[model samples]
Target: MKPIYSRIVATGGYLPERILSNRDLEQMVETSDAWIFARTGIRSRHIAAPGEKTVDMAEAAARQALADAGLNAADLDLIIVATTTPDQIFPSTACLLQARLGNRGAPAFDIQAVCTGFIYALATADRFIRSGGARHALVVGVESMSHIVDWTDRGTCILFGDGAGAVVLSAGDQPGIISTHIHADGAYADLLQVPGGETRIAMQGNAVFRVAVRTLGEIVQETLAANALTPAEIDWLVPHQANIRIIEATADKLGLPMERVVTTVEHHGNTSAASVPLALDEAARRGCFQPRQRLLLEAFGGGFTWGSALLRWG
Candidate 1:
């Protein structure tokens, strides 16, 4: 008998219909389009409309992923949603998504690692499959960051958008999820966070940028070393879309050129936990990835949490 491995079968993503451009921010706050593009490489981002909840986006993405995999909600043995801005406090977003999917029995829950949430949730779901506890799993990363942004604060307001991304994983007997690495430092939490009980997002931009670049570079190396793989072996880099500079820095550390990275920051802004999966789905849909290709996914987010995952595309 071969060891069970978790492999991504399909991917999907959804961004709200409303497009909020930097010029729109100029009307709402005191920021210029040129300034925003120069700093974050974000020209526009999708904004969830009023009454559009995080679970709503998650459900939509999940349904698409399920369809793409030629499976249904009933086939899933587990559902894990990675989110920071859920629809409610009591019911986890995963639970809501499960109900929407008409899935009643399998375990469901949520994980909050900010922008690193997707990577963490993917790692968790991989373990369940490998442990024989789950055969099929749904992993989603969704965010309504626009709901938490302080419209009055130009710095933070210009950095976030709303969207969701999802993937279906199933047990297999091949190389799929090779390795996942996650790390966090609570001491740097305040560098980028929304205080408890507060709706507004805050961040020490310069401080977070310095830490993100250094830590992200280090973790990519750690993941590569652990897997006994080198940068040249990686076919695609689906990185967290927080900042172009940070993404470029990580690619540089991996000795990968910008063309090898899947980037969407210019249009999606930073969708927190949704960034990684969103980029992945987009790249996969564009026919950019091939079966058995080596892929590296990584993210650094508030917690100050950070992680990396190495996998073979299937």
Candidate 2:
């Protein structure tokens, strides 16, 4: 009998209508557009409307993914939503998203690995599928990061945005998610995080930048090794939309050029957990990916968490 592999059947993404440009931040904070763009490669980002919850964005992305996959909520045997800024602390965002998608009794939950969350959630769902516990899974990375940004803190305020991205993974005989690698160091948690029960986010930019570039490069190599492949074998690099510099550094480490990387940071900023899948969906929609192409996905985020996933595009 062949092993069941979880493959991404379809992808989808959603960004709120409100656009917050760098100039807008200039009016609100003490920063220039050139400075923000030069450092983070972000010129504009989306801001969710007041009352727009994380679950709302998750549902929108999930629905689009379901439609793209030609599957419905009923087909999903599992649902995992990766987020740090959930609507409430009581019910997990996964449960809220399930309710909104009209899905029930499929082991819905949330993963909080901060920005590496989508990769974490994707890995978890893959395990369930490989273990025969599930056949179809909905993995979503959604965040209302704008709500957590300290508008007064120019450093952190200029870096985050709001959005959601999702993928439908289903059991198959072919290789789908080839491999995944995840790592974390709580000692560095202070480098990037939001204090408990607080809406404001804080970070040691320089510290996080150095560590993210190093760790992300290491994990990408780990993932490639696990799959017995090399950076040159990857057709596309779908990286976390944290910063263009970080993305470029990772690509450089992989011996790949910037053109091979799927980046949305210039327009989307850092949507936290939503970054990777959002970029994936955008690339997929634009017909940038070909069936059976080798793709590498990676992310680094707040828990001082980071990970990578290698997959065959479908």
Q: lDDT of all the models against the reference?
A: 0.94, 0.94
lDDT of 2 at 181: 85
Candidate 2 residue-wise lDDT, 1-314, digit = tens: 88999999999899999999999999998999999999999999999999999999999999999999999899899999999889998699999889998987899999999999999999999999999999999999999998888999999989999999999999999999999888888999777878887779989999999999999989988988888887789999999999999999999999998888999999999999999999999999999999999999999998789998899999
Q: After superposing candidate 1, which stretches have Cα over 4 Å from the reference?
A: none
Highest-lDDT candidate: 1
How far off is residue 15 in model 1, in Å? 0.7
Q: Ten-residue segment with the worst summed lDDT in candidate 2? A: 190-199
Give lDDT: candidate 1, residue 23.
Answer: 95
